[model samples]
Target: MPTENALPQRLTPVLEARFGLDGGAMFGIIPQPLWSRTNPPDDNNRIDMACRCLLLEYPDRNVLIDTGIGTKWSDKERSIYKIDDQDPGMTDSLEARQLEPADIDDVILTHLHFDHVGGASRVDEQGDIVATFPDARHWVQDRNWSWAMNPSERDAGSYRKEDYSFFESNPDAPPLKLIDGISEILPGVEVLPLHGHTFGMQAVKITTDEHTFIYLADLIPTTSHLRAPYVMGYDLQPLETVEEKKEMLYHADRNDWILFFEHDPKQAFARLDFDDDTPRAVPVNPDEISAIG
Candidate 1:
């Protein structure tokens, strides 16, 4: 186990891709008049979303929290999602930091959703799908992997076979390590499994001596979802989601943990304010944290 001071030296938000999703589905039962106030929808009823990933820099290794949606979409699919990969995208973000895909030491996948894990593999010049981080070990929950393999009809469309099929088909691919339950996959890094949005979806908790950070995957996709009732319609178990949010938010508020939102288009990090009837997220600048350069 790593001591308190042995936590990551730096944290970087890797902006991968920009896309859009149905605002109605994203806000669940929230009235359009309410949600549209914050996240205005496009003519197609889609709201802007970001596939943000986190990069943790340690003394000996660089760990990536998630791989955003990769470059493997057809013209029809791109138009539907309003996919945009050119502006400060994954490759450009990495290059700006003087790093390459091969430099990643480990990949902690929050879940196997197409938008989350699509960048894990890519279609090479030779036209073969292969691991993007060839040298890194990809970590995923065992139950989530099983669920992705045989997804329910409700979310079957979210799982793209081509995005992850290379893991099993390619013998020479990087190792895929499936973990069970809450486990510390790295020093000072822990993963907690939440099943409301999707079976076995994991949220990462990184602890340091001075501060703690929680990578809120789809559990709390955006700051607008800080309210207990703002669960997404895509969630299979809304009640479970509410209960889970209550517990997570209680701890987060009590501990003053900074939350990293994956799908929030405007805000990347925030601290909670529970003084109001509906919990509010106070936006925190990523540059404010010395360790999060």
Candidate 2:
């Protein structure tokens, strides 16, 4: 959002797309009639979920945090979820921000859930597994990476074998760095691990000279789940999610941190403005947020 020469491109971050997908597990204990209004479901009963991906263009590298539900899908799976792939798929969304797939120098995986890591692999020229970020070092939490690599049958759908194998198959795969706690992936890019959404579910935090924003991965998927109790039913440990949110939300509100959501279709980024009773993440347009710092 900066003027042509105001600041370098990479240091000035700009978030991209905000469109919905299908997800019923998000509703959780909320009643169908109430939740349905916020997100109408397809004939298959899957709710319209969002695939909001972030872009951070630094002088040294162009980083993409998560790739939402990609183009590769079986006709059966497509029919079940009512996929609209041939239209504005993930690449098209990235292109809207004047970015091409080849420009991405780093792909950060919050966790290897199908929705989050769907675009990590592409059909290679020889019809084999290959890294989508051919020039970028792919990152994953060691704990979550292992869990995704050897997933239980219950969560098997979350881990696509071909996608995971793509990293393994490429022996020279650009350093698959897996670190713990807070670590810098890029000059101003750091990742923080927050449990509950998945084990070692990490959030991407980018700090500029004057402002900082944390891309709250699956920790707070949609704006609807901003409430501590409004957790995803698919979480392995829902109580842990509640506690993590309780701690983070308070600090997030206090410090005025921008909670850039991954799955909020209508909102690009939101800031938590806490009230006495319930906290609120008032959504801000990309243009408004870009003017900050």
Best by lDDT: 1
What tens digits encode model 2's per-residue C-alpha lDDT throughout 221-291?
Answer: 77777777778878888889999888888778778777787776566577887677687778766666553
lDDT of 2 at 33: 82
Model 2 clashing residue pairs (backbone): 10-57, 10-58, 20-49, 21-49
Give stretches of model 1 more than 4 Å off: 1-5
Per-model root-mean-square deviation over C-alphas: 1.9, 3.8
What do the candidate models score in CA lDDT, each in turn?
0.90, 0.71
C-alpha lDDT of candidate 2 relative to the true structure = 0.71
Q: What TM value does model 2 have?
A: 0.87
Regions of model 2 farther than 4 Å from truth: 1-24, 93-98, 291-293
**Residue-wise C-alpha lDDT for candidate 1, range 1-293, written one tens digit per residue:** 65434778788888898899999999999999999999999999999999999988887788999999998889999999999977588777877778899999999999999899999988889999989999999999999999999998889999988887788989989999999999998887999999999989999998765679999999999988988889999998999999989989989988899999999997888888866567888988767788786
What is the number of residue pairs that collide in model 1?
Answer: 0
